[model samples]
Target: MDLNWVPAADRPDLVAEPVRPALRDDVRVAEIDPALADTAEFCERYGMPLDTSANCVIVAAKRGGEVRYAACMVLATSRADVNGVVRRHLEARKASFAPMDQATSLTGMEYGGITPLGLPAGWPILVDAAVIERSEVVVGSGLRRSKLLLPGKALAELPGAEVLPLAQ
Candidate 1:
């Protein structure tokens, strides 16, 4: 499938140190109208199903006085078990969504465009089991104007990924 992926390396936001090497060979990216960055709108505009787009959410909590971040990828149709499955997985006493500024700064990606492909090491990349069952899925491209389409199984194999029943 010609996903119309331009070189992900071309984007300055994703091409820097510690970021470029993290994107895998199998991942591909494409530009979209910025207005379509949201999953539902993007799906409708692109003729993709809502279920085939995965949302990467950042969840955080403090443990031992250090804040830990986990990237949770769940299908647009479902929601991440943030406080339940995720908090337990991270061993967090309490967990909630990471603030927008923190998420953007830490991942070096736009607010609506973080993906699991190039997240920082040591941060858990939690994948919902259902997402991997698909042959390909759409995810963010590190910018509001683009999206990534890659094999769902490939996402499950990222360095820090843990595939589980992460969606509720």
Candidate 2:
């Protein structure tokens, strides 16, 4: 829990290429062991609570033969309601987790390190209401070796971000 947090903009190398330009002054970064990047392991190893961590998942939503990608952020202790709320919100006939390769390739981030920040301009970022209620939360830094810390409200303020009851 005693992470050496620093301004994300000051340590661009710690974040993904796409996330660099989007780093807000309030966003902080902390380097960590890549082996423990996954939520459970990272929380356990760092003595952090699961509720203080957020998971960003890439969803592929399709309607009328067009596939639109979106980022959904939820508390580590909650599950994204992909098949219900998300599908309805996106107005997509079908919605499902994006393939790992597609997610990483499109986001220009590592598989386990995709964050809502720096996603493609048109992609919608769905933030769970619970996540926005937290004072601070740990999210991916676009690299498995690091993590980003920021106020929950910061995520709600991101471009194209929509605050909703996205958690199940």
Which structure among the candidates has the greatest lDDT? Answer: 2
Highest TM-score: give the candidate number.
2
Judged by whole-model lDDT over C-alpha atoms, candidate 2 comes out at 0.95
Q: Write the per-residue lDDT of candidate 1 for residues 14-111, one digit (tens) a residue.
A: 33344467676666677788777889988888888899999999999777787899999999999999889999999988889999999999998888
The pairs that clash in candidate 1 are: none
Worst 10 residues of 1 by lDDT: 10-19
Q: Candidate 1 has what TM-score?
A: 0.89
TM-score of each predicted structure versus truth: 0.89, 0.97
RMSD of 1: 2.7
lDDT of each: 0.83, 0.95
